[model samples]
Target chain A: MDNLQTEIRQLIIDALDLEDMTAEDIDPAAPLFGDGLGLDSIDALELGVALRKRYQVRLDGDDPSVKRHFHSVNTLVELVRQHSERTA
Target chain B: MDALASGRPRLHRMTHEKPDGVTTRNTTLIESRGLTPPIAPGRMDSFSLPLAAWAAWPTHAPGCAAPTDSPPPPGAVDIAFVDPMLRRRLGPVARMALNVAHRCLGERTGVPMVFASRHGELARTLAMLHDLAAGEEVSPAAFSLSVHNAAAGVFSIARHDTAPATAIAAGDETLGMALVEARARLSEAHPQLLLVCADAPAPELYQDDITTTESAHALALLFDLHQSRRLHVARHASSGTPSNSMMSLPLADLLAGHRPDAAWSGTHARWEWTLDDA
Candidate 1:
């Protein structure tokens, strides 16, 4: 879980062109959008694309649970882990 | 020629001056580089530099020639004033426009803005098209930002300013048309208008169709209606040669205190521009 959290944190920074940020700057429990990282709808879309490309996991844009999956690094780590386990 | 003969807004001229008196308001070239300095007149000599250097070129080398890399990237754009989250999504063209616009606004808010570009968001549009061709899902963010008015819209959102903003693309006459739009927006109530003209070079596939070498560039001009120096624009016959958008070059020269009338041909018309002291 720790490794996955760090990897997802780095992915967010790289995919979003967060030039001033590093993986350590992202708190695992903090929200990825709104008051935490201050991300918006565009970042969500870009991050979804990046995640799909990296994980080879299909993400349905209309899925309601996608919002919960993107809430924080901890949540994103679980989501990726589930997808990886399901595929494995 | 037939288009002109068919009464397509042909040979029209507009003059703007303060009705109350001969007011001399400040006209500042807020932030610009490359084509702003007086280069050799009558040629697109400034396009030879990399897009990043357009506004940074020294005035001492007026006509110094340099080889430009074909299909140069949209070089460094310093738009640190914009919020990082929002700024990260902006493409090169938007970054260029916002960089200049923010510099010109400089603490001023609630001003009307006119953004002019010959190929607004062309690069973004091309990228989206490629995604579609590859059977990839076009990112919703990219699609939304690919519009012509995306820059102006983003600028308004970033500033939280609700003042009127307009985007224009009129082929080679984009800059002239944008100035016309700015003049129309100016009034006694809104004495000043911010005009930004920017363009990124067309994508590599379309480079062969380009007439003159174009490099990415953006310029901001602050126009005060009460200014004593008035600009006169009139349409005339074509100069009998193909030309690209180079209005910003002469505009920069004029801003640099060169008191000379200039003329340039666009795709469909010839425009004669002169600045005179009222």
Candidate 2:
């Protein structure tokens, strides 16, 4: 869990060009959009593309599960781990 | 303002001061309050204000030169920036509108205003053509957004600004078209008008015909002048060597670089000038 958190945090920073951010600055449970990382709707779309390209996870705009999966670094890592494990 | 001809509209030709590498031309009106919504450094997406506000959170090396003026007006305003990356993904209409809108309303919410983009949204139009080529249905959203005035619609919704909105898409004469409308609206008692004119680099298909680079430029004209201030317009050619005419410079340049003592009025199309506010 710890390792995955670190990896995902780095990915978010790299993908979004969060120039001032380091992995440690990201909170596991904090929101990504408004307060936590200060991302916006367009960032959400870019992140969606990054997730698919990196993890081979297919996302649909209509899927309600995407909300939970994208809640934060911790949730995203857990979701990625669960999906990867099931596929493996 | 006087009509030279009685019955028909008099044609006006715009003359631009040629810039070294840039091919677009524009003139702007700056009110006493500074350009409304004072654009901040690195704040690219003032129309997509979220991108601008988020980008301006003091992280990256500061982008544009710092404003010599005071801090931006307060509010949770919607803004967007035209960082090269995002600009590459947008269509011409979107590109032009976003550029102009950002210039006008980056961070402050004042009276409701109008947005004018001559080319409107060209990317959507290109996509519609591509869909027709592929025997696929043109996306309704794309079709609607393709309209010349769609940028104004998006600008309005993005800002949650319900003030009277007008969008004008006049072919090569977009600036003249929009200016006429702006003048009419002002006559009808509208206090302020935000006039924006932007055009994108010609697309690949049209490249052979029009060789302009992905030219993207916008200007904000704040028409609300205090009674003490007067805008003057007269037909005259520039006497000095034209240095920065063809290219679009940042709003700050137009505010500071031009002769402040001489009030200027000119339309962007032919880049003609009628010195006003002298």
TM-scores of the candidates are 0.77, 0.50
* Residue-level lDDT tens digits of model 2 in B1-278: 54433432333332234222111223222121211222222221100000011111111221122323111221112245433322323454454455446555556554444555544556558777997999754554455556766666566656666666766554433444444445444522445556655554444666564322333444445554232233222112223333222122322233333444322222222223222232
DockQ values, each candidate: 0.58, 0.04
Model 2: how far is B133 from its true place, Å?
Answer: 12
Instruction: List the candidate 2 regions with Cα displacement exceeding 4 Å.
Output: A1-3, A17-19, A60-64, B1-109, B117-171, B187-189, B199-206, B211-216, B225-271
Ten-residue stretch with the least lDDT total in model 2 chain B: B45-54
Clashing pairs in 1: B33-B54, B33-B55, B34-B54, B34-B55
Candidate maximizing lDDT: 1
Candidate 1 structure quality by residue, lDDT tens digits, A1-88: 7888889999998878787799999988999899998888888888889888888767887899989999999988899899989989
- Residue-level error in angstroms, candidate 2, position B251: 13
For model 2 the local lDDT of residue B219 reads: 49
lDDT of 1 at B252: 52
Of the true interface contacts, each candidate retains a share of 0.78, 0.00
Q: lDDT by residue for model 1 over B35-148, one digit each (tens)? A: 122212332211000011113111322112122322223345677777777777788778878887887777778878888988887878888899999998787678888888
